[model samples]
Target: MLTHPSDPRRVLVERSDLDPMALPPDLRRYEIHLRATFDWGRAYLTNPHPDLGRSGSVCPFVSASLKRERFFLAVHPGTPSDPAEAVDTMRFYRDWFLELAPRSQPSAQITTILVLFPDVPQDAVEPLVDDVQAMLKPEYVGQGLMIGEFHNGPPAKSGLWNSDFRPLRSPVPMLVVRHMVPTDYPFLRDDPEQARMYLELFGDQVPAQLRDQVERERAVGAP
Candidate 1:
């Protein structure tokens, strides 16, 4: 976790008195929600890509990286009504996210960051999600942190399954942050450049068997 301080006043998770569920000290809130949403727990998090981890659940690997201090979740309720103001807020989030990474440690657990824009429609949330990704991805290469948005928007096609089940689909507009891994190639393959970048980022840590696919992705991405 980052040693840098965040203003407790502005953050909801810090204000546990207001919403105890914001960031529970124990398994209370998180476990309950995990059970309540089968798709997120049973399907997405648990299911691994055949191409990636044989047949193991993706959750255990990711969960291993996380400790009680590593978890960070932010619930933002609104997107400003004004267009320009909304953009400003998005940029602020992008900047804040960059700093969320621990200063002393270049690498850490997934350090999940979930931004909830519940009042905002999918249309609004989707574009903002793109904007944030565009703004931060390049700066984060090889840095080990991964961030994503989950809104009422369209479901992201599964990288692990043939079915149309969208693991990223959620009821509210939420953005997630976590540590990066070599197995993420499935998600980056569609964008050849991103795939190459991801390969470069993970470097030699990529598994021996997956080298073919990784090199293939880099080759495909080459100009």
Candidate 2:
């Protein structure tokens, strides 16, 4: 069901000229596919999806810096397959993203850091994903950084009325970084405190009905 980026149908980022050791085959292939894939609400390195303005593309600066994507791979030296090391790697990347993403000039801003772990195997991935989300989300939710993980874990089921079951799965293991938005409430809604935090951050822009729903849902769970 998945075809690699070398497929003639897909667009590529053209990273062939870069040093092979600095950008090896797998990472190079990732960069190529990233530009073609319709994730991140856009073809990351390709032309902007026409619907982006009406959809989830909040950071306009992202498109301008598409060719200059800011990312790091966490696979060399040793794999961070160990839970503790995974957390440490995530923390380090989080720090790097916090320091690097926002400081760029307005026109050429870096919205998120693409943290890739090209070496992690299937058995170790799910736990690492859970660890990353649990450890970082509390501190980063409203603070302008988001961490999104993609792996072979069974697709996450839909929270809304039945629609899709595995929409979040990816061909390779990936963790994306970007700012949080109002629409992310569904993903954070299960936790009352996080839901509260979401409202505090975006209540002005959230709809009255949805705001009441989030409150009512939280209040019902409160002991």
Q: Write the per-residue lDDT of candidate 1 for residues 165-195, one digit (tens) a residue.
A: 4556665555565656666766666665566
Backbone clashes in model 1, listed as residue pairs: 110-179, 150-174
Each prediction's Cα lDDT score?
Answer: 0.52, 0.54
TM-score, each model?
0.63, 0.61
- After superposition on all C-alphas, the RMSD of every candidate to the true structure, in Å, is 5.9, 8.8
lDDT of 2 by residue, 158-202 (tens): 424335434445555656666566667787787767777777777
Evaluate residue 170 in candidate 2 and report its C-alpha lDDT on the 0 to 100 scale.
55
Return the clash pairs for model 2, or none: none
lDDT of 2 at 54: 35
- Which regions in candidate 1 have their CA more than 4 angstroms from the true location? 1-9, 12-54, 65-67, 82-100, 103-107, 122-144, 220-223
- How many clashes in each structure? 2, 0
lDDT, residue 37, candidate 1: 37
